[model samples]
Target: MRLQDLSAALSDLESNHRLRRRATLASPQGVDIVVDGQSYLSFASNDYLGLADHPALALALQQGVERWGAGSGASHLLTGHSEAHQRAEEALARFVGREAALLFGSGYAANLAVITSLVGRGDAVFADKLNHASLNDGCLLSRADFQRFRHNDMAHLEQLLAASAARTKLIAVDAVYSMDGDEAPLPALLALAERYDAWLYVDDAHGFGVLGGGRGAAAEHGLASERLIYMATLGKAAGLAGAFVAGEGLLTDWLVNRARTYIFSTAQPPALAAAVETSLRLIEEGDERRARLAQLAARCRERLDGTRFAGGASRTPIQPFIIGEDAHAIRLADSLRRQGYWVPAIRPPTVPENGARLRISLSASHEPAQLDALLDLMLQASG
Candidate 1:
């Protein structure tokens, strides 16, 4: 870990095309944006409902700053938690059909908080192989006996559950896989949780504000249980910053008192909380937006049906066209960027080795013609 060693590591990453870079965004997040001084029809955002730059949300943010100021001076346990945060938390809890909820700065921190506080060395945690990195890190850091099931494999999970002799057992999964865009078997997982007397933790970062009429993945599955602990991000389809973990009342009580991330971190700005309040109302009334998003995704899938970059089993907006090599995926993304489309190439360790892809992130703001034009250019490139 010396400076020279770090430099060597960086060089190794670049040589293998594993280096990462950030584009300079000159405009707000939406389909049409200026990244690195170029205007582009972009498909590189998670703003599924296209509300990131909504006038009302922007105005609400401004008003929030006027009412509360720039930052919360302390953590929630001190004086940082505001009336805005309280109201937002209450709304979030009700929206997700939970007895309570606790806000966090980001989904990563939320996952860590949930995992670490609930389990220790005497406990056990079973996770999906494809769960988000944060979840994996959380489990590793929890000092729990960590067991991983094959992706979406219930029998493996059951075997692990049946074999564990720990004081407590928890099952962790993503409601919708972030990269693949497929859903977990929540009903079956819940049945196993009930059968094994374990807790179920669901990270629904990519499903909220788009599924279940914006009530979230839990509602979409028509499932509920006191055993379920749910976390959804506000920054995705909700078009705001922060996350909230919701579940039975006592669960939140434990997090508030025991979760290190929440107890130690400064609260998100009051402006963000106010904007989230506005975003929640918008998400609840966003049926038209969701419909448009679904239509756009379906059309793109249809257009790519016979192409080399055919769609996978994803039903959500995250359509990944796996190119199998880092260099190839980067080249495809670069070619698209030159043509005024801004698709992103995703490579490891974000995905498995040799599974690099052009991640097509769709939004309700996208028009059919825009998508069609991109696909035509794509087909030309691949052809």
Candidate 2:
């Protein structure tokens, strides 16, 4: 009976065109790759700076393994923390202009640790409607009085803040919204946080290593505040695994002592930390890569002009092309895949209902010809 129920649910998902399928990648991440035994020019990766397969990063990772072996061997509080971890934390904090930073194995864990540890039942967490799923999960797990404002509606957020009587208030938002490829107004949100005496949490997963000269969105906005808790993932533009949360010294200490995800989970392999240290240097000096990425993004958007997909508002590498219906989105994805392009259709739950889209992720490694070709195919399919 239980199996039948589960199967029925899966069938519902399939019939509604909301079921997800994973394609096996038989090659390293980059612009061109093999998925499901077929080669494709992919616009589906988060490797924005084109460093995922770089020789320099590979060398650092190999060197780190030689020095630290493969694993940390225990949770951080016990014997897991190592010199490699310490050095990476220091470098991350310094790069993001914070006093300290704490590393986590993934962005979801980092968000969970920060949200759950910082607020509780009596506290209130204000969030944007379009925040990432990890953030939403954290808010729910925290048991905090969670309230969400309309997407980018500053006035609504302010209203919620003013009305909350909870002594501890937190405003959590994605610096750059993933599915929509839109950025939250950080400066404006910070002002509200200051006025309301609340903590402002900025999750810059999509902005770090690509925005603000590779210092991230806060640096992009020239924002530095004790009230701001900044978190970013290394897996996206950083072209590595894991995530980090940077802020005041006390926050790091508190998380070290209290964050359940940190306390209970084994530390990420120390070798990854050494690689991240190298990634930091590369990201800091990656002006040319960022410039190329910008040019590519601009060109992609410019080419979409005067089409049904015109006015692609994102200035970032993530450009979402809305397709309205689920089946149509799947068809478009199939069409692109058949044309040797690997753009996936983002459907319900990952996006709003009737807001299915092809999440066209761009990379600096992508040649202009590849992008132009993909865009032309997309326009043809849409037409």
List TM-scores for all candidates, in order. 0.98, 0.98
> For this target, which candidate reaches the highest TM-score against the unseen true structure?
2
Q: What are the RMSDs of all candidates, in order?
A: 1.2, 1.0
Error of 2 at 22 (Å): 1.4
- Give Cα distance to truth, residue 181, candidate 2, Å: 1.2
- Regions of model 1 farther than 4 Å from truth: 307-313
Clashing pairs in 2: none
lDDT of 1 by residue, 279-306 (tens): 9899999999999988987887888887
Off by over 4 Å in 2: none
Relative to the unseen true structure, what is the C-alpha lDDT of residue 358 in candidate 2, on a scale of 0 to 100?
95
CA error at residue 17 for candidate 2, angstroms: 0.6
Query: What TM-score, to 2 decimals, does candidate 1 have?
Result: 0.98
Candidate 2, lDDT over the whole model: 0.93
